[model samples]
Target chain A: MKYILSFVLNGQPVDVLAEPTDTLLDVLREKLRVMSPKRGCDEGDCGACTVLLNGEPVRSCLTLALSVAGQEVMTVEGLSKNGKLHPLQRAFHEHYAAQCGFCTPGMILAAKALLDKNPHPTREEIVEAISGNLCRCGTYQEVLEAVQAVARGEYAEVKE
Target chain B: MGECIYFAPTEIGEAVRLLAEYREKVTVVAGGTDLLPKINYYQLKPEVLLHIGRLGLDYIKEADGKLVIGAATPTSKLASNPLVAERASALAEAARQSGSAAIRTTATIGGNLANASPAADLATPLLILDAELLLTSTRGNRKVAINDFFVGPGKTVLEPDELLIEVSLPHQKGKSVFLKLGRRKAMTLSVVNVAVRLEMEGAQCKDARIALGAMAPVPLRCTRAESLIKGQVLDKSLIDRCAAEAVAESSPIDDQRATSWYRKKAGTVLVARALARAADMEG
Candidate 1:
């Protein structure tokens, strides 16, 4: 019942023991201890467990670990480089977007997926992109602003 | 709920062999957007999981004027596929409206059909598109009309030894419309969904198909409604009557998303809207 799952985590290659039934979220949080992605609804109904699978946002909770064998996966912890927080994180801090902060990781990753595809997304586009992520903190307006700030060229150098 | 073994086969022949070898001990999981939850929630427990993820089943192809969608083709692909968007706009729109971005990205069209949820967004459109499902086994392959694929909710006619390989449809030659009324704007189950496809000859409805979801134990084609509109020049009076016939085809039960009474009434309205939109597409 045990299988070895190999994937690129952040920018490093990782090989981890996994159960075929175990989800990527389970392995990432428990086995790998890369715990930025939160488990809100075990079902795919909520985006709390959203992570980047091969540069596309997917619900980690719904993704089987076996399915992700030899693929690239990214979580919010991987966003920062050289000890500098990603612009979306910095923007969230400045905009006060995190109330309870539980949803921040998923929110930032979801927004990053959008910004990666569309560097200069419109306000509506930003909203639609993060629509899957639910912020019970009622910080939706501020989250919108944080994503909008990143799109407004507030951190152009961050892309490099 | 218990320990399970998973098999990942890279070849279709190997996959078919595994299915035959394992039989009922195995369950096929492609997207796992639906199956994983059931496993986690203890709704389903199979000793072996036959994962088709690595089988290279994720594909969209055009063969002999027919659009062939692989069993593992993600919902996101159908939503934005240029060929699907142009030829089968209703299905594309249904894909676009289903679940959310993450769900669309990971969920496959085959999983949507195989799960056989009555509220499945893609099923109604696929039903109206006259889609055919191809199932394969060690014995050979067989084609089943999408219309006859579903037996009941959360059930399909797939045998334990058979795996759905492809879904095919001829280029839709009609103006089509899809309407889904969900509890929320996104990531919610449809209360009532309707798909209408009209083949028009200068405003006269040459042929028609009306499919409704969340209206019965299975997604249904409104043959009576199609009969009313077929060969008739659609107008306000005929459209109204056609909508009524579509409603008559529904047999829903009360559930968390909606009540039978509300669905009975809303089903008619959604069908009417879909037909009206299809007519406008002709205009």
Candidate 2:
């Protein structure tokens, strides 16, 4: 029972054939070939598959693909516009936040979701926002620094 | 596992009709926080995945002197809702600490209650608050007290054709608090969680309700412990005795998170702490 699942991916609309059991992570990485969101854990424990569903951070691995029909999903691939990185992405690259790069995509998107809602989040809020995403390389410190730098207006050039 | 039909009905009547038609074969998915993981692991392969997310059940309102929460309402919304925080502080705290921010965004109270985990974070607070669950089917509707909802671990009284539509909490006059003991701060299941509500008249306790989670096959109300505090002043010694008495009603078991012996010890302390916090006697 494959259905045509139509949803807004990033800023564009997309329709893909998906099964009832297919997860959002599966459709994004496999069907659409959007490789930003990682597949570290098929379960929801590891937040490697974190993405923005309607501007809120959610575990795509645990999200049913059919459930997200007609909703908006944003990933790390959609952050950059005209080859210019989003503020969070640029800050992560500059602050050495990507150790293994496995959790970077989810981490950055989670931060973006936070900053979008709360443009200025405190250190604790920043930590709590990305608490679900686990960085196996232990780059939490650097990730924290990167998110803090953005919060402190260090990367004020690129608003998007 | 091969072929499946997914139905995302927009209306509640339509959803219940589908559930009645599919019966045991339909798996109702509200948040998909718990069900998808089981589906991914092949632990549950439903022939019909009935998504109730779009059933217009994500809401919170007050009616008939009760706080009515829609079954599909997410935990994050509950945690931040001003009415919930003011009226049911224990439930708000429990919702705030249920899971990580991401999990809370999608996880629903109905799904958590339906899943019927022994350590369900929402269960303790709801139990202490004397909440009632409204279960609906194509035939009719019935309201069950929260205390009578759970049967055992991963089991509830919900029939295959019935759907939990809403949870209604009557206005209670008490200061309540919730405390959870987990392996870690976030994204961890509770080893033991306690919720205490105390209706205090100056120094003497007017009424008390104590609920403990992960200390039994289901979330349990410590009737003996609660009765001990009624019409009595809650002092240090009395609180300790009540805590011990509450733990006596539990039949915890050794699992990956904790041992039965350890749960009794830690649950006693946790209950005492929650009682103190609820009574505003914390030192």
Candidate 3:
């Protein structure tokens, strides 16, 4: 069945027709062409499809499009404002967090959700936050450092 | 192309009616974490997708000295809830380790129970807590004990017309702990999981409920072990005996994740650790 889903995407109002079986990841990548959220695993195992639904990080690949109606959906593309990257994005670049850049968007968004909720999260908490995301490069230590840097507010003005 | 129909019911009554009407053709979805994955894997192909997310069922409330968790309440909520942490520490711990943060944010407790994975993390804690599950349909509402909720893997006693409404756990004075032996620390399926709740009378074990997961077709309670520790002091001998008894209760299979021997060994270790932690909390 066709359902009209109206949601705020990256600070912009969006109304799209989505099938019930179509995942939010499919709608984002196929319909809207917001291709930042990649289709890596297509399953929830790889955090490649991670996006913020109502300001909380969730695997978009497993999220049905109809379930997100009326909620605020934030993609990695929405993380920046006025051509400025989010602090976590800058931290990733400064700390060389991304290797092939495939898992970058999801990792950054997951960190964004964590830092927003807990600005001073511990190392264990940082690891727990990105535990769902899998970086095949196995750069967990560098990724952890980058997230910790942003949480400490050390890179707050890096994008500016 | 034929498309499946979708129904989003804002009210519980409407949801119940929709389920009744759709019957076998419908599947209820809350967070869509488990259901969507199954659907994508072609394990489930329902003609109608009934979305219950709009029913405002995502809540954890304490009423009448019971912690009532709505079926739609996310794992992330349960993991962070102070009441769950204090009253049902095992449940909170299980929720914390269920999946990744993103998966937990989307995975609902009801989905976990309904999925009926023998290794389901929440099942062990709920079993130890003696939690009651409420199932609602257009006919009426009925409550079933968590132990009786599952029949086998990926199966439950839920009727086609019934929807799981909430899970109510009694507020008890005791110490509880949950331990999971997964392949890795995070995002790994359990090889063996254990939950132990100890009611202590000044260091003497008054009562114990030990639940083991992934070691059988359904998450099971080691009643023999529970009986062994009743009215006895929780010392090394008792812990060892109970651990051995817990291992005896398991009928683990040789699956890809683990072997039967390894599962039995891990079950013994988890039971001991869970009991020890519960005893420590009592002390």
Model 2 TM: 0.98
Measured against the native two-chain assembly using Cα atoms, what DockQ does each of the candidate structures obtain, in the order listed? 0.79, 0.83, 0.79
lDDT of 2 by residue, B153-227 (tens): 889999999999999999999999999999876778899999999999877899999999999999999999999
**For model 3, how does the per-residue alpha-carbon lDDT over B1-283 read when each residue is reduced to its tens digit?**
2568999989999999999998998888888887877777777777899988888889999999999999999999999999999889999999999989899998999989988899999999999999999999999999999989999998999999999989999988789899999999899889999999999887699988999999999999889989999999878778989999988988999999999999998899889888888888322
Q: Give me candidate 3's TM-score against the actual structure.
A: 0.97
Give a tens-digit lDDT track for model 1, residues B2-117. 78898889999999999999898998999989898987777888799899988888888899999999989999999989988888999999998898888888899889999999
Better model by lDDT: candidate 1 vs candidate 3: 3
lDDT ranking of the models:
2, 3, 1
TM-score of chain A of 3: 0.95
TM-score, candidate 1, first chain: 0.96
Q: Scored by CA lDDT, what does every candidate get?
A: 0.89, 0.93, 0.90
lDDT accuracy of residue A26 in candidate 1? 93
Between prediction 2 and prediction 3, which has the larger lDDT?
2
lDDT of 2 by residue, A1-160 (tens): 9999999999999999999999999999999999989998788898989999999889999899999999999998888888888888889999999988989999998898889889889888888888888888988899999999998988886644
Best model per TM-score: 2
Model 3 Cα shift for residue B75 (angstroms): 0.5
lDDT of 3 by residue, A32-140 (tens): 9999998987779999999999899999999998888878999989987888878888889989899999998999888889888999999998998888899999878
lDDT of 1 at A125: 79
What is the CAPRI rating of model 2's predicted complex?
high
